[model samples]
Target chain A: MENRFEKQEEEKQDWGAYVKPPQTSRPSQESEASAQSSGEQLQRFEPRSETSSALCDIVREHLHALVENDGAIRPEQAAAMFAHLTICRDCAREFDELNRIVSVLNSMPLSPLPHDYSGLIMLRIEREMGGLYPLMDIPPNLATSSWTGEAAQQTSQSATQLNNRSLAGILSQTALPLWSRVVMLGAFFATLLLFLTSAWGRATLDATLSTVQDWLHQIAQATAEIPLLGAITAEAFNALSQSVHLLEETYLHIGANAMRGVFLDTAIAMGVYFIYQGRQKAKRAG
Target chain B: MRTVTLVEQSDAELVRHTLCGDKSAYNTLVLRYQRQVYNLAYRMLGNAEDSGDLVQDTFIRAYGALASFRQDASFLTWLYKIASNLCIDQLRSRKTRSALSLDSEREEGREPANENRCNAPEDMAVRGAVQEVVHHAIQNLPERYRQVVVMRHLQDMSVEEIATALDLPTGTVKTHLFRAREMLRGRLRPALEMEADGK
Candidate 1:
């Protein structure tokens, strides 16, 4: 029995070498050598007793746990299983094969996700949900344009418009409290009034109100002063002058119209106030 | 910025918000699990389109049944169970279709040509082949064994977790896993030996 125990210890050492190959400079080559060695270990193993059948049953029962735990069997229990594997070639071969299969399984690379896989899944779910909820649309800038290439420019513009519309939709939703909405509107109109009526605003407005020719002359003078800006900057300056001229024309047109429509504007504001008051009264009554 | 904070919320917190009729919260749950569910489906069904369909169906089913979901149960595990059951159904239907199709034999003959175009390195190709063989072998196992194998190996669930997910005894789960591994080892040996020899 002592001799048998000594032999078991020797076989266990061999099993360790069989499981863990020597480290080498090349990882791929080391793995190949290990695989070959493991295969050879399986081939050379020999069964020493007729009790192999019972041992095989034990191996089968504990196999999953052993493999799952990465063969870190406790010393006491390892003696029996390792002894059985050392003497019984069939169980040993099966054990080696199980280890190889598991290593391969664990080493298996994950398959690449399908193109737009998440998007496709989400789209399907949205479709199944009766299209009641809008699916999260891809941002125009991020959406792949490879299919249409340059033709996507037009589609991207529409996508941008859709994004803007969605943003507006969210802002209009009843998520904001009434008090917050009122505060936001008040702040917005107050800022607009200050921009329209302030001294700095009026001075800036008058400065931008130059005639088309005068704007072009000013742009040319600015372009001459910044010679390092080159032809591109000059073209940019010319575009800016044209834009300012258009803005000035638009400002004058609006000013003329506003002067004639003061009474109408007051009437409209009173109408809106009355409508809001009536709705509040109706809501309170209900 | 708000989205970043939303994404950082725990699954339980998201689920709570979802229960409170927050649609975007449910969307967060979907985003969190979509990749994992899709990958699981792909590994089981071995096809992107079918996997995608399974993922969508899984989410929709989960959403519809969210009210019944016990808060204490793992949301990921629950989602995986749904995906696994759907994958099984998909595999069953695919098997029926393949058995009925006369061109399946021809398709099998063309498989080598398709495999050659996998566009991977030698080690990667071997790994891919190993995975394919394992997946095919798994698909051939009995339904219970297949489910246990997927949960144990692919989904990386522990024995107890698999048992809980499948509503099986832990012993049963282990037995099925052992049996599945045995079957897989048998199917994979020749290919593995060839791979070893080639290397």
Candidate 2:
């Protein structure tokens, strides 16, 4: 990870590149020499001249102190800086630029508040306050009620028991292999079929089937007696049938789309795997 | 039915009322400082949504710890301290989690369309560009310098107030502010010059 200072240093280097050309064009040999120097000594031991690059550095350091102190530097230092700026064109220009930048920053407008700023904050505070003291708003009468006390306790106990029972049921269901469950269901159905094939069981099944058919026939006859009702019922049944057909079509379309996606994914995965393997092989050969 | 105007209450008066079980007094306090706190957070975090959440969290934390608040300290400075700490924590966590991408920073820097209410489109565009450049420069400052810069320039805080909030010496805050501004001046010079040339 890059340290924040390292990033700032990189930015400084970039800025130096941008600002160097103007300084280099100056006719001062000492400016170029100071600019070329490296390490910590560059800042401390660089030779100063009226048009030298180090002049800008000196002016900048003083400018920062002056600006931060709101021009309240000692009179002697301020006079010296002003005198230098009057004599040095480069330092004066740099000073004006730095001052302009500071003014611009200080004068940068504050963003306008959102229209409902206070309302939103109050809402949030209220919500947080409610969370902090949940029962603060509850009336004293309701706070001491039996329903909120003993009844709540009973409800909680019942909920716990229900949760435990449901957990046990889930565990039991998962304890058996899926195939075993299927086999058990199939065997039960087979035993029921065998019992129905016997005389008494067959008789009971036939009677129930006949009763369902007779009820359907009666409903159809009553509907037929009212032609309007019969037509509406027929239309409703047709709509229901169409809905079922549409649902089946949708299911098929989704399944086909899912299969296509899976195939595409597998192909991409295989291509990546081959590429990776080829790279590994080439590495070994090299 | 005795009534008093909430806006008339001083911070100390409001704190007194809040401690005495009047929630409205606290609400009044939130209303008073919400914008400053939000603007500070927004400038620090550079995301409006995150800043909003920080503001809400700061107030909630302040409410919870109101009992320990010292009477001698300025309320705004105390609130700023909480917000600054939260923002620093966020920045540290973010640095640890992943490097911030320039693309995401650009995206976050885009203001909401509705928020731009300036009448002159050209001037607004120029101002926006300059603001973006300046914001990027500030974001690039090291963490300590960045905090002082945001507090002083963006938040319009006094040096003493900032020193108090950050628990730093007055001279140290001044030094950081100076360095931060110098770095910003270097970074913003080219872009601002271009804008000037274009004009």
Candidate 3:
């Protein structure tokens, strides 16, 4: 068997030059089962001519075959083709390269849409088309239009009573422009003072350092007894620790103030500013 | 009352009805195209939430612009053109916004390392590294190459279909695919080597 295999391998290298007939011109009706029983199959496996590179062309085409889903070459005629690739280093490398390309391509991070994606999309579509609520009309008993005159009058009386009872209800309808002005003035002063003290004045950092320094110093002293310090070195360590504390305090204070001033407070001021601007514009237009 | 089944009606018929003041018919068209729209946007954007919003915006815009669409063009093609143009606009805006964010991060001396870390792996470390390299490589590709690569490889659109969708010449589509493959092949060389070793 080994000898036969070696003979077959040698025949492939030398048979690369056969005058191959056109593939389509070959007998098409040579069914697989019939070819298996007849000696015609073995004749088909005979090596190509020793002068033609038809076998090499087939082998290169097999490179594309390796990239295909099955990765298997078919037909008894392809036996000689495989025999050539087994011995040819270039063909083997080509096969390896094709396989490598596919493997790497598969390894790419492809985030296909979520699995329940179709269902979720359908759900959203349904929601958008009509809300989850069932579309039923109000029953006649509950319908406002069906109410008796006395009942309607009582409903209106209760609504007016409810409306009259609350100071907010009256004030909301009444003109409170003077009161709003006073309130705006108050908010302006408070925002101005808060911004100056916390941001520009840096008072928050000072206050926080004064608060946390005692705790920080005690902890530093406790840690200073460790071997790395070498000596009490209190003055140097204390100064170093104080500076660290100051740095941390400044960072926290600045972050907190920015959160307040630039984010929350700025939003508030912008709202107030827009209201003020709108009022001014209305007055000018009026 | 006869029920107008969406499936029984052609898209152009639905649009005609919508133009004739049948709001439900227009909404039906939105429902029909929303999936394809969302998939296209998501594949284009690489993020799901943004893609969903884009799909909604696409439908809303399509509804608003439905009257202007000539009946000569297929409704799907018209909608696709609108969606594609919006996606291009979105990509441009996102680029500018990303640059601003990067500048802000640099100015603050705090790099946004965690941005890339969201999709980072935890246990599959080796696979994670390979995925990271490919992700960055894809991200680094020129926009045209990236778009074609995603459409061809990810969406599995045929070259002809992609050309039709993008309104590019078929040869241009093929060239883009070829270049994308070469660029990706170069970037994934190490992974290719590992795969060859059966690792």
Candidate 4:
């Protein structure tokens, strides 16, 4: 009994009547007209089958549904009663032909959607989600029906139009070429050696330093000029004090530790000068 | 002009707004193309979670690289390229890992049952069996062929659209679709023969 039931189940699995509507290849008006005419032709003429009356009745119903639906016969309907349809050659032929027509009809596509699909799409647009394009103001005149490549291209082109240069460019300039940096170091040492070894160069250096100090002392009038001159003067004084501190520790016979406070004093002055310059620049720019 | 405007703005305008930091405009694109991106990822990866993440990642990466986007390529096409490359990378990584991954395991488990059940009854068990078979068969297809076939049939994309999106020639898209279909037809022949024999 179990084997028999299994066999019956297997028999029911037959796809003799199961037909998927041919995915409509085209939905041309002419093709639709022809499908209607072909359907009418089938309606006017009933296929004759030398088979059981019940089987014939099934075929007629299936055929009528196929015509009315323009070939949208279901696979479930076809598979349900394959036994009768397979034996009747005429019905099978008619079914196969109709199935082909339905495939084309199925390809016709769904109905025209409402105009608001675009609006619905607009509502769903995210501010942060454009894959390659950030959002901005688009002119009201350019809105349209479908998203075309031309439009995407235009938007992508526009998104990159702003100038927001980053600080990385300035930082990258700090990386000097090896040869030039080495040359600069060599020139600085050469000038220092010349100043110390040559009595005339040393006198000239002392004279120039005194003149610079006098000029620095005179520049107390304008607060605006303080940052510009003060930054340079502070940097010069810090370097001079650092060298003097080293000299005092090496040869001055003074308590070297006493100059610790001098280094700190120079550093603080440089820091204050830089901070003041930064604030002034910020205010001016603002 | 009136009809087009009544419907929506041009894609170019939308892209322009997107570039100008109009956050909503970019969202429009995301919502418009997320399904396509998701579908491609799903077909390629055969895992919903991975596909979803891949789509999101693709969008994120695309956003970062938006400044370099060329105007000549279709936006969706550019996006597909990003999504496809990501899927391919995921697939390649899966291949190198030596362990049999979840996607593979699902394929291995489902393919045989699907083969057995396509001609089976319409009951729940049979329906599940057929669905598994469909998924398994599609999942097992070569990555390129699998993408083309899904993009064509499931997504209802035209060969031209698929070609444009993938940056392949139309001929290539058609060929891939044809070969993919042939492969499916062969895989499915057993069920057809079974149905034929039962009759």
Using all chains and alpha carbons, the TM-scores for the candidates as numbered come to: 0.53, 0.51, 0.39, 0.40
lDDT of 1 by residue, B1-199 (tens): 1113456555654564454344566787887788778878877776788887888889888876665677678999989888888887877677587645422432342222233333333444366465666666555556667677777777677888888877789878877878778777765677776676656
Point out where model 3 deviates above 4 Å.
A1-286, B1-4, B68-77, B98-137, B189-199
Across A1-286, the per-residue lDDT of candidate 4 in tens digits comes to 3321221244354444444332232111234455455445444443464444556666555563543332345544444434434444445445554443323322423222222133333333343543322221122223242445854444334333321232322222343334545555554543443343333543676654444334334432222256545666456544543454344334235433444454455557556855875676466334
Interface RMSD of every candidate? 9.7, 15.0, 16.2, 10.4
lDDT of 4 by residue, B1-199 (tens): 2112201544445555555455555566776777777777776787777876776777777766665677555788788879888998999798779464544543343343343333332332234343344455567677777778676666666677788777799768866665555555555444433333333
Q: Lowest summed-lDDT stretch of 10 residues in model 3 chain B?
A: B117-126
Write model 2 residue lDDT over A1-286, tens digit each, in one string. 6322221232122221122223432222223243233222333433465445554566556776655545345544454454445445555556656666677778766765554355665677677664332112211222222345544444334333332454332332233434545555554533443333333444666644334335434544555557645866445434433344343344356664554465466557556855875676466334
Candidate 1 to native Cα RMSD, angstroms: 17.0
In the order shown, the candidates' Cα RMSDs to the true structure are: 17.0, 24.4, 30.1, 17.9
Of candidates 4 and 2, the better by DockQ:
2
CAPRI accuracy category, model 3? incorrect
- lDDT of each residue in A1-286, candidate 3, tens digit only: 3322333444343323322322332222224344233324335444456532555665665444333423243333344554555444445445444445444544454455443233443345455633211111111111232335654444334334433565543333333434665666566544543443343334655544444445446655776677744245445446644665455555467785564655466568768876986787466334
Top-DockQ structure, candidate number: 1
lDDT of each: 0.59, 0.59, 0.52, 0.51
Worst 10 residues of 1 chain B by lDDT: B105-114
Q: Sorted on DockQ, highest at the top, how do the candidates line up?
A: 1, 2, 4, 3
Worst lDDT window (10 residues) for model 1 chain A? Answer: A133-142
DockQ of each: 0.15, 0.12, 0.03, 0.09
DockQ of 4: 0.09
Model 2 chain A weakest 10-residue run by lDDT: A134-143
Q: Could you tell which candidate, 3 or 4, scores higher by TM-score?
A: 4
